[model samples]
Every structure is written in C-alpha cells, then in structure tokens.
Target: MSKSEALGAVREVRLSGGTIRYRERGDGPPVVFVHGVLVNGDIWRNVVPVVADAGFRCITPDWPLGGHEVPVPEADLTPPGVAGMIGDFLERLDLRDVTLVANDTGGALTQIFVASQPERVSQVVLTPSDCFDRFFPPMFAYLSAIGRMPGAIWLLAQTIRVRALHRLPNVLGFAAKHGVPAEVVKSYAASLQRNRAIRADLGRFLRGVDKRHTLAAANKLAAFDRPVLLAWAEEDKLFPMELPRRLAAILPDATIETVGDSYTFVPEDQPRWLAERVVEFVRKHATT
Candidate 1:
C-alpha cells in the first residue's frame, strides 16, 4: 500500500462516489488527520509517526485536490462539502470517539464538522488554518490571481519557473527567520510535483470561501463547550498569527499554543515539537 511519499501502513480506500482518498494506521483510539488544501496526506508523513507511536490509530486522507494522483471532486468542494464528506466517511467507518487534527483549509472544514456533529467528535487541534474574516494577505491575492489565470496555471504546471521564482524567496525567508529545514520545503515540493491532479485540485479548492460556513462554525464554537487546542504558527506567512486569538475568543473552552517562527507547514518545519504538544494536548483533553 506504500505509494510515493505517503508511507502505507494501512490500506488506501477511495470512497465510492467521492474524490477523497484515505488510509488508516497504528492501533488504539482513532486519530484522523486532515491536511490543508493542495497538500496531500503525505504532508503528515513526518508527523504521523509521532501520533502512531503514541499508541493511537492514525488515519490520513488525501483530501480532494490534495494528492498528486487524486483529483479534487468535480462537485463543489467547498468547506461545507468537505465537512460533509468527512462526516460521511466517519459514519461509514463507524469510527467512535475520534480525535481530529486539522490544518489550514482542513481546519476550517473541521470547524464545520464539529459544529454540525459535535457528538461524533471528541477533540480538535487546529493549526495555521484560515477560518476567520481576517483580510487575506497580498501574497494570497497574488497566488489567487495567478492560480485563476488559465494560462498562468498552465505555465506553472508545465515548468518550474513560477514555483522557482515565486516560492524560492518565501522559502528562503522562512528558513532564515524560523530555522525551518530546507529539506522540509523539498519534501513539500515533492508532494506538490508528484501529480498534476493536485494542481487541478487547487484550481477548484481555492475558490475563496463562503462566509456562511465560517460564521456558522464561529457561532457554534462560541457556544460549544468542547476542549480545543489552537496551535498557531508564530511566523505564519499566509494567514495572520492573530487568528488563533480570535478563535480563542470564540471557542468556549480553548487554549492557544504558539509555534515560534513556523509558517503554514508547521508539522514539517517543527514535527517533534508539534507532535509532543499535540500528543500532550490530546492526552489531557481527550478523556473529558
């Protein structure tokens, strides 16, 4: 079941009538990891071991438009749709007492799932996610515009020029400031390059957002009395670090942990630290 960067400790399941791909590993209580947009479950390769080693069953899924080979579903892959798919998958698996670890768009989806079906979820860990109304940074606008342009996206997919030109600076800047290893970027790039479907998936996945889901989740978060661990990167380049603070304000029982100088790829840049903190947080809150 091992394929490419995604180490296979379990069978990969392509849900019927869905574009998402999934695999489960380890043994014990279930811990499902949902990755950010444009990132496959392979993104969790470095981090999954920590959770698996901690005596918990680990499940990582290739979100639609997330993996190199997997295509993002043709249907609207909105945040709410993502939430619905996850709920459906969980129900199909009959998974009980689950812990959800989500980052970026995955985090936003997690919020929707938690709000809609709180009883099905046990604990949550959200990191470097875009779940608020904070104005998107200029880079996002640039990426969005570039991604939206058919010709630009085609050129980007055909050659390494755009990524080389656009991402290099940001990568170097992040490494220089945060001590993030260059290998992490290379690994992330490998996942990005492994398949063209990921690029295609990105085009559909990054359609901004529907504020309804965001507001609905926020309202539920404010009212829900669930234990949530809000881990945010201190040097987030895409989304502002202040978002976790806003999330904390809304979440009834939430605690914020800062990852100093990490970017959106916190798991890769600081795997050991993140693993320790996440395992600890889950241990403390999962039982209640």
Candidate 2:
C-alpha cells in the first residue's frame, strides 16, 4: 500500500486556536511525530508505519510550519505559542505519557513543549534539530530576516520552485544527504506556494525564531528529568555533533546515539534506522 494508505484515513481535531489534520496508524502507547519548517508529517511517513506496526499509535499531524495544507491565522505562531499549541493538541486528544518524536525545527519547538509542559509527555526522541544558540544555525539564519520583510515569504514560496535552487545550502541541499524525491519536494512546497494564509503563518513563526526561546527552554530542561534520546545524524551539515553533545549535558536523563550516513533529515535519509531506534527507546523506557 502507499504511504498515505498505510497511514490510514486523514482525520481532523479542533484545538483552541484552529483545526489540525492528521494521520494515525496502529495502537498502543501514543507516538506523536513533529516535523520542521517547509515540511509536514510526510517527513515521518516512512518511519511512522514501522513504529506503528511494532505496537505504537503514531499520530503524524501537518503542523502549521509553512508546508501544512490548513492555515491557523488566529493561532499564535511564536515559539512558545507553537509549543503551547502542542500542549493543546495533547489535552484535546487526552493523550498521556506521549512519546514525542521531533526533527529539524520541530525539535526546537519540542524542546519548548517538553520544557514548559512536562506533565503529559513521558519521553522524547529528538532527531537532528535546532538547539542552544544555533536555533536557525548560521546558514539559514536569513530566514528570520526574510520573515520580517513584507513580501519576502511570497518570494521564497516562488523561489523554491526552481529545481536548481533545491541544492543550495540555504535550501534543501543540506536537508537530506542523498536528496529528496521530486514529488515529495513538490508536496512540501505546495501549501506555501499557493496558500497566502500559510505563508502568513510561516512568516509570523519565522519572525519569532529568536535564540532566546531555545535558550530559555534549555534552562528549564534540567527540571524535565524525562528520558530524552538525541538521535543525531553523524554527517549533518547544518547542526553539528556538538549540538547534541551540549543537549546531552544539559538534559538530566539524556543520551546520544549517532545515525550514520545521514544529514539533518534523518527521517528522509535513514528512516529504518531511526524507526528502530525510536521503537527500542520507547520500549526500553516504557512507563507505567
């Protein structure tokens, strides 16, 4: 079956800010996947089924991070606001002891989520993502500036359509080591390209991408004390190995595991390895 088919029918849930579309599969302890900017739950498409079949309920939502189909204009797109939206999602679904898995920018937002609202989450698995002072890293830091410009988001939406630009350092070049599928890239760009509201939401979030949010979250991480697995990519060009090492030091109960032959988008380059690590980690740290 196709990935979408395997993920089951699309479903919707109404949060306080807006409605979110998601795909769910399997059963057991809940596993909510959070993706980064310019992409949606499709980032975890390959990894989700494996973990789900291994006995976990995988909920892959199209988080409002530029690439999502639905737009939450009324929602707060700031770092803490997006983090609180995650908490709202959990409360709306009444999911407890959730195993939160995140990648890229989602990892940064996840850090904010678990640090602020540690009550519902039992454990966290963060793949190569933004942390510490390098929240946007030096390469794509221009995004924050672009977000502030009046029409910069629209220009970015148009610029990404050029296939040649896909390999640029600030674009998708360093996202996956090998390269992403053309069709997948198309899906990742569609919402931002066509939906003005999606662009607005993205711009608002990007404008709020200050390192202070991540720094503040890091300060509170020690108090979380939950099992955190830093599943980092060995050859990530954007976020270096030191990022995870620093996180390992700050989080009270955190460990680092390197995934070989991968870049920032581990879910794209090494889905099976990531899925296995996630399954093993969750099962090993399953709580009562």
Best by TM-score: 2
Candidate 2 per-residue lDDT over residues 190-219, each given as its tens digit: 888998999999999999999999999999
Q: What's the lDDT of the predicted structure labeled candidate 1? A: 0.66
Would you estimate the TM-scores of all the predictions? 0.82, 0.97
lDDT of 1 by residue, 188-231 (tens): 34444555655665666556455567777887787567788888
Error of 1 at 252 (Å): 1.0
| The 10-residue segment with the lowest total lDDT in model 2 | 1-10
The positional error of residue 87 in candidate 2, measured at the CA in angstroms, is 0.4
Clashing pairs in 2: none
Model 1: weakest 10-residue lDDT segment is 171-180
